[model samples]
Target: MRVLLVGAGGVGTAVTRIAARRSFLTHMVVADYDLARAEAAVAALGEQGTRFSARRLDASDQDAVRTALVDERCDVLLNATDPRFVMPLFEAALAAGTHYMDMAMSLSAPHATAPYEECGVKLGDEQFAQAAAWEASDRMALVGMGVEPGLSDVFARYAAEELFDEIEEIGVRDGANLTVEGYDFAPSFSIWTTIEECLNPPVVYEKDRGWFTTAPFSEPEVFEFPEGIGPVECVNVEHEEVLLIPRWVDARRVTFKYGLGDDFIAKLKTLHELGLDATAKVAVPGPDGPVQVSPRDVVAACLPDPATLGDRMTGKTCAGTWVKGTKDGSAREVYLYHVVDNEWSMREYGSQAVVWQTALNPVIALELMATGAWKGSGVLGPEALPPRPFLDLLGAYDSPWGLREER
Candidate 1:
C-alpha cells in the first residue's frame, strides 16, 4: 500500500518507524510544511528508508494535496497534522478519490448562548456531515483513529460484542506518569491539541440526556489505572471518543477523562483565565514591528516541542476503556487498556511513549485496509469496524493490551 503521510512531527515520525518494519506498506511519502523535518524523518530510517521518501507539502492547500495524492499515486492520505488542517486534508483525499485517516477529527466550537449546557458543532460533526458524499464515492474517511478515540473505541465495541450483553457506561480514562528530565512543565503530546481538548467545555453522553456540554474539567474522579501507574485524578475533557463511540455502541453513558493532576489542571485553568489558550490572531510585537500571532501558538512555541523529548522522558502512559455492564444476567466491569513504557518505546522506536502509542493504531488500521482484513466505506470510527482483528494485530507489533476486571 502506498501512503501520503501529511505530518513529520512526533506521531508522524513514529508512524514511519513502525511502518518501516511492516511488510504491507510498499511505499510512503512523508510530507510536511517543513521540508527538512520531513527529510529528517525519512532519513533517520537509513536502509529502511528505501521505501520512503520526503516532500514539502502544505496540509492546508487542498489542490496541492490532491495533486500530490494523484502524483504520488497514494492509495491513502494519513493526516498527522493538527486538527485545524483536518478539513482541508480530508477534502483533498475525497477530491483525489483516496482513503483518508486522521488521529484527531476536525475542530469544534462551543454553543453561542448555552455553551455549558449545550453543544454546538461537536467533535467530528463536520466530517460526519459529509458522510453521504463519501458513501457516494465509495471511499472511507476514518476520523479519530489515534490511541484514545481509536483504540478505546475499539475496546468498547469488543466489550459490547463479546463481554457484555448490555452496557451501562463506557468511559475512556487516560493517565500517564511520564515526565521529562529538566522541564518543570512539559506536555508529552502536541500542546496545540492539548489546549484545544483540555480547555474546551467537555461533552458527556447519556441515554436520557443525549450529548450535552459541561464546564471544563468537570466530573472529577479518582480512577485507579493498572500496571503500576496507580490511581490518578481524572476529569472530564472534550475528546473524540465521547462523540464517536455512541453512534455505534449501545451504552447508557459515554465520557472521556484525562488523569490531569492538580498542577496540570490548574495551569490549564490559568491559561484559560489569561486567554493564553485562545487560537485567534492577536497583534504582538515581533522582531520588526507589530505582528498577528495566535496566543496558543505563542504558548506552544515557548514550550519544548514534544517530539524532541523522547530521550529525556521517562515512565509510562495508558489509554483504555472502562466499561460497566451486564452479561448473562450478571454484572460486569472491565478495563481494557494498552500501556506503553517511555523507556521501551524510546529504546525500540526512538519515539516517546505518548506519541508512539498514538502512532501505532493508525498504521495498524492501514495495514488492515491493505490486507483486506478490515473494509468499510463513508465516515467511520474505529468502533465501526471489527475489533478482534485489530486487537490480534497488536500482539504482532509487540505491543499487547491487557484487561483488568473491576467487578
Candidate 2:
C-alpha cells in the first residue's frame, strides 16, 4: 500500500525504519515542513529505503494536504504530527477520500466554569463529530494509534474478549524507569504533548456517571509494572484511552494514569504557573523585530529533541491495561503490557524505546488494513478491531506483549 506519512520526527522516523523491513508497503512518502528532516529520515534507511521518498508539506494546510494526498495517489494519510494539527490532517483525508490514522487525537478544552468537575470538549470529540462524513465516504479515521492509547486499548479489548466474562474496571497504566545521561529534565516523548495532557484536567469514565473531569494528578497510587520496571506512583492524566476505550469495550469504569515522577510533576506545575505551557502565540523580540511565537514551542525549542536521546537513554518503558472483573464465576485481575528497553531499541532500530514502541503499532495497523485482517469505516479506536490478529502481529515484529495475573 502506498502511504503518506505526515511527520518526520522521532516516532515518524522510526515508522519509516519499521515499514522499510516489511514487504507489504509499496511506497511511503515521508513529509515534513522541514524538507531536510524528511529527507534525512529516508536517507537513514540506506539501501532499504528504495521504496521511500521525502516531501515538503505543512500539516496545518488542509487544502495543500488534500492536494498532496491526491497528487501522490496515497491510499492512507498517516499523521505523526502533534494533536494541534489533527483536525486539518483529518479533514484533508476526508476531502481526499483516503483512509486516515493518527498517533494522537485532537486537542481538548477544559470546562469554562467547572473545569475540574465537567468536561468541555473531551478528547477525540472533534473527530467523532465527523464520523458520519467518513462513513459516508467509506473511509476510516483511526485516532489514538500510539502505544498508550493504541496497544493499551487493544489489550483492553483482548482482556474483555479472552480473559474476563464481565469487566469491572479497565485502567490504562503507563510507567518508565528509563533515564537519559547528561540531562536532568528530559522527557522521553514530545514535551508539547506531555505538557498539554498533564496540565489539563484529567477525565474519568463510569457506566452510570458517564464521563467526568478531575483535578490534574488526582487519585495517585503505586502500580507495579512488569518486565523489571517495578513500582512507581501513577496519577490521572488527560489521555485518549479514557475517552476511546469505553465506546467499544464493556467496563464499569475507565481511567488513564502516567507514572510521571515528583520532579517531572513539579516542573510541569511550574511551567503552568508561569504560563510557559500556553500554546497561544505572543509577541517576542526577534532578530528582525517583534515576532509572534508560541510559548510552548519556545519551550520545546529549548530542550533536546527526544528522538536524539536514544544513545544516552537507559532502562525500559511499559504501557499496559489493568483489568478487574469476574470470569466464569471466578474473580480475575490481569495486566497486559508491552515493554521496550532503550538499549535494545537503539541497537535494533536506531530509535528510542518510547518512540519506537509508539511507532510500531500504526505500521501494524496499516499492514492489517492492507491485508483485510482489520477493516472499518468512520472514526474508531484500536479496540474496535480484532485484538487477536494485532497481538499476534506484534510477536512477528519481534516486540511481543505480556500478561501478568494480579490475583
- Against the hidden true structure, what lDDT does model 1 obtain? 0.95
Clashes (candidate 2): 0
TM-score, every prediction? 0.99, 0.99
- TM-score of model 2 (CA atoms): 0.99
Clashing pairs in 1: none
Query: Candidate 2 residues 33-89, lDDT tens each?
Result: 999999999999999999999999999999999999999999999999999899999
Writing each residue's lDDT as its tens digit, candidate 1 over 1-407 gives 99999999999999999999999999999999999999999999999999999999999999999999999999999999999999999999999999999999988899999999999999989999999999999998988998988999999999989999999999999998888999999999999999999988899999998999999989899999988999999999999999999999999999999999999988988999999999999998889999999999999999999989999998999999999999999999999999999999999999999999999999999999999998889999999999999999999999999999999
lDDT score of residue 272 within candidate 1: 91
Clashes (backbone N, CA, C under 3 Å), per candidate, total 0, 0
